[model samples]
Target: MHVFLPDGKQLDLQQGATALDAARAIGPRLAQDALAATANGDLVDLMTPLPDGARITLITKKNPGEAAAVFRHSLGHVMSQAVGEFYRAKGHPADAVKRGVGPSIENGWYQDFDLPEPLREEDLPEIERIMREILSRNLDFSRREVSKAEALAQFGGDPYKAELIRELPDDEPITFYTQGDYTDLCRGPHFPRTGALPGAFKLMSTSGAYWRGNEKNPILQRIYGVAFATQKELDEYLHRLEEAKKRDHRKLGRELELFVIDPLVGKGLPMWLPNGTILREELTRFLREQQFARGYQGVVTPNIGNLELYKTSGHYQNYSDSNFSPITVDDEQYMLKPMNCPHHVRIYASKPRSYRDLPVRLAEFGTVYRYEQSGELNGLTRVRGFTQDDAHLFCRPDQLKAEFLNVLDLTVLVLRTFGMNDVRFRVGTRDPENTKYVGAEDNWNAAERQIIEAVEEVGLPYSIEPGDAAFYGPKLDFVVRDVLGREWQLGTIQVDYNLPERFDISYVGEDGADHRPIMIHRAPFGSLERFVGILIEHYGGDFPLWLAPRQVAIIPIADRHNEYAYALEAELRAAGLRTEVDDSSNRMNAKVRAAELSKIPVMLIVGDKEQEGRQVSVRERTPEGHKERKGVAFDDLKAELLERYRTRA
Candidate 1:
């Protein structure tokens, strides 16, 4: 067997040799340092056997993108072993601790176990100690494949493992990896030896999770752990975790009075508080202005539509699982709309005739509903009901690229307005092998090519992701990195031929014939709820002047100055600024502290001297504490704030 390296070097090795052997053949240091390998761009464990003429790139700690998953996954196995050992040491039989599936997730790994005793948060330390002890043994991880019958027999007592084996396809290999006394059913590319793992791993927490995420199944105690290739990286990640905790949207939402998820209202349903509603309104106003200027005609649609409407648009058949159950009123079935495009399509179909109206841009701040699982719901980010900044452009084929470019321009403007300037793009195309997509092959190819060309022309950085396209179309998603360097998918523009075909929507062409118009679905702010959540975390609850729920807080130094503070608040509000006056009996310092904690961008301190001068002392709340910019004329302050608000600074 032969394998090729990036440098075009080839090595002839024994048949069935793994990537580890290939690395060793290149250099002993490379073999020892290698964490994983990319075999033809597909990530593989160092233990994965290389095929003849395969291209392999050794993934060391330096390539954290690929190496992190391998490291974390191997750590999951170690944690599972440690958990089992901890239980056995506590007097439970070795086999009494039944292991469920354990897999690596983003930034970490988690393993589920059906144990004799429930795992507590306090047990993490002992589990970590056991993991370290196991690491010290330097035990080799040996892999083996077994038949279904053998695997079922081996794990018969563990119903979870037995069920998994029974469900697996006959052609799929049932594999397991063993390290000393610990063996687990897994198809893995693991570290050759226990010592190959870095010591920079920690058991984070534990929680109850159903086996295979099915509520009907037996609940298992799941332990989560995060690992990194180096201690510095681990420290940095932990620091970020701490920062994330401080910026968690749920916490900020409550403390800042942004939004609330009331179980009484329903799970996964969020109601925006006054402050959060201001955020939503301001964002909507900004985008609405942009869309209006770009020739988008705003439209209002109902929250529910006839079930037949979705069936005609293919949403009923394709997205039934995500949609709430149908409501039958007077023998007529209606559904809470999971999307706004179909309604917009109906509006387009209402009155449309000429080629001149080829690019009919219809926009809406439409709220949509989806049946999200309870466990999956988190604050406003993942909700059952949310509003989308949605728009659909029915354009002629020739106008598709230009319309897409315009939509992209609006999306970029919106992102930059919120200070999410670091952007990446992904052109999501249909998987050639996936039959789930509804469009014709040629249409899919054309839509994918159109998006790619537009992205290329705009000179935006992007990658192609196969199988990520919506069932109806190929889409381009804008992935933006916030201030904290975390990426969020904020906006999308999709091209669809399927929807037009399914709905039979058309416009009279220049040739005096009916022609199907390509539908371009776009959401500059994917969902107002999710976008606000991300924005809260990105800005650490300190929004920009234009978007700030309360732009200014006027604090009176004394009861005598309360009237003056109110006057200043009125002036600021009249100038289109969101302002509030602290008229409570609290001390000035306490008022300032409260304002700062509320993340008010500007604090105006009103006192006797300021009242006489018709000026206000300004204190700006920064990432650091408030910076005092002593007395400025009220007129001047208002002018500066108005300018900043106008420019969205």
Candidate 2:
């Protein structure tokens, strides 16, 4: 048999030869390091024999990042073995511990377990010791495919494993992995041996996780561990986690008085504080100005609509659970809008005609509500009620490409205005099996093709992701990474054909006939509330001069200088900067420290010398050592700040 490798070379092999065998045949050294193989572009255990004439690529330790998830998955089993051993050493029977499914997640792995006694964070060290011992033993991992009944018999007394087996599709084969005396149910592509756990693995923490991620299921203790092929990589990842923790939006939002999530107000409902409101209003103002400049017509729509409105848009069937329960007002059942599109569609349907009106762009800072689970809520990023800076463009089929290109230009401009340069875009397409999509195959293909061309024309790097599409459409999601390298999904441009077809929306064409319009739904700033929260952390609350909630704070060295501070504040405010006078009795050091802590972008000092000299000392919120003590002409500073604001920086 011959299989073409990812590099396009064909390799001749014996019948049923696996990728592992192919690697070994290629070179002796390659055989020694081969961790697993991607057979036909699917990651599979080395032990699994390949189908005849399959594409093969052996993943190894050197480029282990691709196989990291698989590696962490195997390490999970290694941890389970160590935990069982630890339990035995204490004279407790291993059977008392029950295991749940453990899967690999980004940067780490976690496994749930029902233990006789709850594990403590302090107990992790001893568990680590046993894990190290098993790693040093260097046991070879062995795998077996068993019959469904045989698999059930193997885990007969283990309900978690048995339930897992019972839940799998009847046609799916059951497989088990064994290393030393420990056996686990898994479909694995392990490190080939236990020694892969060498120095780079550690049990980080434990949390309560429900079985299969459902709150109604039994709660099990989930122990999380991060693994890498080398210690340096592990250290770097750990350090990054620490930095992310400090800048986590949930933590920073509270400390900065940006937003509040009150349990009494219901989960995922965030009330913007005064400062947070200021941020939201500024972002809205910026987006409205930018949208108007880009030829978008601002549209106003109610927050609730007749239930049939969503049914026509295909969201009721797909997203009804996420939307708030419908409100019954007399004879009509209205739903709190879960999306802005349904309303925009109604607007487009109100009255429309002609190819000249083809690319009508409607923009709005529309507030929508969704019932996100409490556990899933995280600050402003994931929330129940939020506003989307949304717009929908209705265009002719032939104009799709140009409309997409214009949107790309607008998206990049918006991102640059916010200083978000590390952007990643993923083009999301359909899941054919689901059968919920309303468009024809050709229309979906055309939308995807137009987006691909526009994305390419912009010369931006992107990836295509399947199964992430809207049921009515395909979309391009723009994600931005913050200072700590944590990526946040911020903007989106969706090509929707299903909605227009379902709504029977059409406009007059050049041929004097009605033609269906292709809808392009977009929001460069996905949500003003969420974007501001991310921006706070991305800029570490030290917003660029124009966007800062309080752009400049006036500081007085002593009580005698208070008058000048007030004068400076009034002058800056009148000149169009958000300015404040700090007339507190605290000393200069305390005042300056407070301003710095609050992340005020600029501080204007009005001491007796500066006041009498008719000048103000300016201190930027950059590092202290980078300070410049010179005063700018009052009018000059104001003009510069206004320019920055006008630019939406």
Q: Name the candidate that leads on lDDT.
A: 1
* Candidate 2: regions farther than 4 A off: 1-20, 23-27, 166-173, 623-626, 631-636
Clashes of each: 0, 1
Candidate 1 residue spans exceeding 4 A from truth = 27-36, 45-48, 59-66, 145-153, 166-174
Q: How much lDDT does candidate 1 score?
A: 0.89
Q: Show pairs that collide, candidate 1.
A: none
Model 1 TM-score (2 dp): 0.94
lDDT of 2 by residue, 1-649 (tens): 8888888898998987776788878998888888888877788767877888888888887787777777888888888988888778777887878899888887778889988788899999999888888889988888888878988898888889999899888888888889999999888867788875446888999999888888799999999998887789889888888877777778878877888988888788889888888888877877777788879998989989999988877788888779788889998999988999988888889986788877889998888998887777878888888999899999888888888888888888888887789999999988787776778999888888888888888798899998888888889999888777789888999998888888888998888898999999999988877887788777767677767777888888999989877877787777777889888989888998898888888887777668777777888876343365765665576677688777655
Candidate 1: tens digits of C-alpha lDDT, residues 297-353: 999999999999999988999987898999999999999989999999989999866
TM-score of each: 0.94, 0.93
